[model samples]
Target: MAPDSTPPTNEATAEFRAARDHLLQHRGDIEGARRLPRPEGAYFNWALDWFDPEAHGNDDVALRVVDLAADGEVRAETALSFAALSGRSGQVANWLRGLGVARGDRMLLLLGNQVPLWEVMLAAIKLGAVVIPASTLLSPEDLADRVSRGEVRHVVAESGLTGGFAGIGGDWTRIAVGEPVAGWLSYADSAAVPAPFTPDGPTRADDPLLLYFTSGTTSRPKLVQHTHRSYPVGHLSTMYWIGLRPGDVHLNVSSPGWAKHAWSNFFAPWNAGAEILIVNQPRFAARPLLDAMVRHRVTSFCAPPTVWRMLVLEDLTRWRPPLRELVGAGEPLNPEIIERVQAAWGVTLRDGFGQTETTAQVGNPPGLVVKPGSMGVPLPGYEVTLVDAASGAVVTEPGAEGELCLPLDSTPLGLMTGYQQDPERQAEATAGGFYHTGDVAFRDADGYLTYIGRTDDVFKSSDYRISPFELESVLIEHPQVAEAAVVPSPDPLRLSVPKAYVVLVPGATADAEAARSILEFARGRLAPYKRVRRLEFAELPKTVSGKIRRVELRGRENELHGSGLTGGGESPARGKLEFWEEDFPRD
Candidate 1:
């Protein structure tokens, strides 16, 4: 089949294309991109309206997955064109409809970075059903919670993971991919169904489309609800942040089930009509990942700070990648890591800031001056502000820190509808005429937003507010440190003091001398008040999505220093390796 020669003529397609083209035209003009009007339509189905027409008879590659074995050899490779994926997803949709799955049904989709994951996502959208994405790394206990909280009416998982849901009691329909499981419908049956799927009804823009369970870094995960327009159209900002162009090969390092996965893996790249590239390895090794990028000629890349940190540890100059754009998110990236990559690859790693509740609200768009430690200006379509947490007053003074908030008066299309089934929590989050991000930051005179830390993660020492991220950024500069998490430890005089949990690089021993070296390194860089008073050499606790759980470290510190009055408490003799500043000499 040849690609469609004629341009899109439908109303929805015209509206979407006009809006998308405006951003592309003004890719470097931030003010012009912000002035572009958002697409407003009563009825829109992305699968039916935009993707199907754009993909019709198109031979361009839509997705490519490279599977790596234990020894870093390519075991298998799969590439699906836009037209092929459209027809396959349509067939899957038809097959799913045959299994009694209907509009508005909640389906729990658990799979890895396989073709079925993309097929099922598109199928669910075409069927007008709500999709609840689940990671394959989830335990049985985690699956049970999602089953209950998500109110899942159907489940589609790999046959190998069917056992995790065996004990999970639910009335949902089971559909298995890979190999067929007993009592579960086989996804292979979808191939027999014909393409050209028809929708049951027109999809409303405000209808619930996706339910995402956030990675609980501080507390239990919250169910975040997104409407059809929130993510699909909202990710225009994300597309711009990544600097994606049509036919570009983009690889985003993220796990399944996380919102970032959907942000980059699905919506962002697809919105730009770019190919979604994946490097599927059982475990992440920097060399194999770089090899995949080089082989695929990936033009755009996005990964978390952890991956960037690991990549910088390797000989980055050895591989000459054709990457034109690079981005880091999930956490604020340190300047040292970004500088190292720039020195080796001559490509600056741009930082972006967003949450599960929204798309790329703030980012360092292409051709912009990226300030050190700043996550850049607000993306187009978002009205970002810094408001005082205590008084709820907007902070106008430059360099004055406050919680990052987005005004709801003219709410951006990217923001989530709200937390599902939790009206009180939702109300609290969106109170004061703004949607609270729960993260803190300060803007400079030039309007670049520098991330501080999460509201819950920031603490005070001697009445001066302290951002753990500020200290952690300095700690990682030391060659010995691989990863570091900062939390407030109890102190009688100052009420609280900064403590660091450090993970050493390979071959570095976790001993008194190592602790002294790290502490002294930090002391020379950080202020006296922000100095790490206590140090513990242990593996940092991380959420399933790989975010550091600072809350857990704070809890551990509180437990160790009961009543917050114990000045010099005895360290635990067993379990985690621990060290302190007093254990070493001041010099």
Candidate 2:
């Protein structure tokens, strides 16, 4: 029996057509679809298979990098053709191969967002070596753990970060990107290697390409394994979500070594044949980033919620950007931020949902209805479901909060294989015939999924479930608030109450007056159970990868309660904070 066929109701967009074509190309053959064979000499090589440097040799606008030097001088880089990058990367690949680096050998890269980083990345891909990108913010202990856990055989890092790997001993080739260091090979000498590289074997699409050490806010970072087909091929959905077109200049504010960096800086734009525009800055200044966007004629822009919050604090209307498409990822964008940006720029901020373990699973695509807080439906070729945490049964009823899960049967290209060296954890994460996302969300009648918070981040107060993200979103609406992280603080009467750790704007004072104003603003917007009961003026703890470590705050709360220091008697200081039950209205 055949399934009932349905007719199209709306005009088919380019993305719809491309997705349909892809599905047709892979239908009834899962193995064939997973192994999309590349033509001979191509063999799933991104440099060769996806991009032909010879054909696009003269296209000088492939990359444009603006370096914000330490001396506050702006060095402009422009018109680096694809052919030049390919040749240089090939030379680097040859040099790395000469250093006894073999196929499938894991190499750790710790560098700034410099040209050498991109060059070495492409080189590693061409050489069929698995890359483990590490953030420069990683301490010596973190570096040692990564080196040991990831089983890295080679290290390529900037000169400044060389001291972090001092005591870690391994039989690994050391290569420095910025300057020549003692006992390390200089990347400048890579030019001496041959400009062409011959692959010893064909790179199968299923071959391991990247191994990411996730930004573990709750626990230790997981070594997430990705295949060649996973990211490069998988991010087609992301390209669709961001509405990237050929020749479009896309600028994303993401540092090197994070998953979002690879998501936007590497795959999404390149897959759409768009020019990658990067502005390397020491710190995130709203004015500078906005000015760069306008000056470069950036057509598309993507950033995390933190940047967006700062951008809203500035006079955004003064800097009218040429941006057509805007996206928010990494963390959920509050409705207030999206509304403000849309009103100022006349462009909607589309929110996307995914993890370090996968590509963009759900996103508000271009030309689609933008639900205020909902992270839109699943992208093409992916299936998303809400399952009960206790029962592990699918929840079809709308508005019911459940654990967000991806179907195990429909293996998407963007998902990582598993957590390396921890099968038990992997099994627990991918249980119940579904890959548990560890995040909680609720699906609407229209299938728009709105994020609640992390499974551990969501807590109960007075027997009512409270999502810190929901409270934080409301708190950030106040103009004085720059960043907010909410956690369940201990309470003797109600068992627990929401406590907000806030970072105020530059001009905003962190006094009782400012606190009272913010509390009033939240009281008017949030529900009785969800209102922030306490506000603390402190910097939020963040992982090395720049994600807010809510777990740290949760631990602090647990400690204060366990030690019997936070319940009844406490003076409210400028830095310290407490709230009364009557602060928020009972109604």
Candidate 3:
């Protein structure tokens, strides 16, 4: 398909038509129609539009990546003007073309947050190749699975990771960075070629741009596919959410190979023409990251809740940066984390919600009042609804907790095309003309969406429904608690009760006294129905991508406290152990 150079107009395509109707009926009957405005003649082809050598002319500092080493040494600094990056990536594109890398071929990229990563990314995008970004942390077993299941035709990785793909099969072309490998092309050599590329075919807006093998938290990795128009254009909402402006330096703490990386690093900032600032480090250390932000004069920032929680453990008052905005994603941000950061920095931390399948669906947009513990309202282009799981119908009544589903009618540009090669699963997911998020939320009367746990994570105890997020939020408010994850533990009498796994802050001892204090803290904060009856202190299990694995925690609880509450059910009761409603005024 040829690229549509006629420009997007007021005309409503089928996806747009359906999306508009759904939003009008549910979110804003009158104002919804006016909010969704299409772009005119604005092409998101980074190679052709932003990275043109002649277009940029002599402008320096198009992108700058900073590497803060683990040994407290500054490793390298890479700055490429718009002209240089474009020309270098163009040479890489030409080199790849010579090596039989055709347009739309799947290429697996396993590299760190380095200059070559961005260069190769632009080159592949210009050549119209579907990139599968893999983390350098993957083992041979993981590599073989992706190579076999992802239908990859080319392998591009750092020299350190070349041995990890030792026995991977197929006629996959090998391209290595950093060092020479037998039978593999050295990526360093691509720079020596002619620094210009001419495309053989026009690029389509809806062409498949990226193929991601999602981090399998529960099941096998699913290939999540995105079109050129979907991600590059769709992240406009993300730019709006972060309040990113041109020339603003934005740093996002996310690893490569994940969707969040592309969400913040690639499109969101670039969409607003902001400088993408990166702090590349071997191991995560809070002080170095904070110092770099101050040195770079970073204005906007985003991080997963895990990183935020870790940072709060240190003395936040010890460092100050020129930060204007801070945002959290990947997981719901607890109210405690927000409060701590705000108290220290005088800047409120906002939270946004989305999945691997889409960009910022719900977020606390700029100029909006961010409600504590709520993930804010739906993004401008998304028509989000709380649909009843049992009835399979949209729930309009306020305070009704239901599955978070996006209507098919709201054809947001950021949504994935479909799960690659899985029609049956896709059909089940997109049932009833909606893309089911599999997550639950409750929209309050004022229109803010409070995240309930995942559909499988929410459960009932003694006929009372429980939201782990609600309890966990309250748990973190305790001074000693650094992070918390709440889930149902089986009980014979109550059927199930909320159990908490907590990480303590610095100087907080994991003793019976501390546990008791946290229990009392939760008792005062949460209602009787949402009390944390049992508590344990242990490192939370997380996916390789850093998402808390509640599913795994739930399994551990079931194994330990089978079928009911018992005195011996607790796992080495850390800190001071205390129970809610035990000494409280009970009805």
Best candidate, lDDT: 1
In model 3, state the lDDT of residue 459: 93
* Model 1 residue 534 CA deviation in Å: 1.2
TM per prediction = 0.97, 0.90, 0.90
Cα deviation at 106, candidate 2, in Å, is: 0.9
> Cα deviation in Å at residue 341, candidate 3?
1.8
Could you give the candidate ranking by lDDT, starting with the highest? 1, 2, 3
Give each model's clash number: 0, 0, 15
1-587: candidate 1 lDDT, tens digit per residue: 34767634478778888888899999888989998678899877888888888898798999999999977899999999999998999999999999999999999999999999999999999999999999888999999999999999999999999999989886889999988799999999989989879888889988889999999998788999998889999999999998999989999999999999999999999998999999988889999999889999999999999989889889999998898999999999999998999999999899999999999999999989888899999998899989999999999999999999999999787999999988988999999999999999999999999999999999999998899999999999999998999998888888988889999888999988898999999999988988998888989899989999998889888887646444455543222576777778764
Model 1, position 333, has a per-residue lDDT of 95
Native-to-model Cα distance after best TM-score fit, residue 448 in candidate 1, in Å: 0.7
Q: Which ranges of candidate 1 are over 4 A from the true structure?
A: 7-9, 564-576
Deviation in Å, model 3, residue 465 alpha carbon: 1.3
Mind giving the per-residue lDDT tens digits that candidate 3 earns over 314-433?
Answer: 788888888888999998999889999999988889999988889888988766688999998888678888899999988999989899998898576588999988998899889999
What TM value does model 1 have? 0.97
Inter-residue clash pairs, candidate 2: none
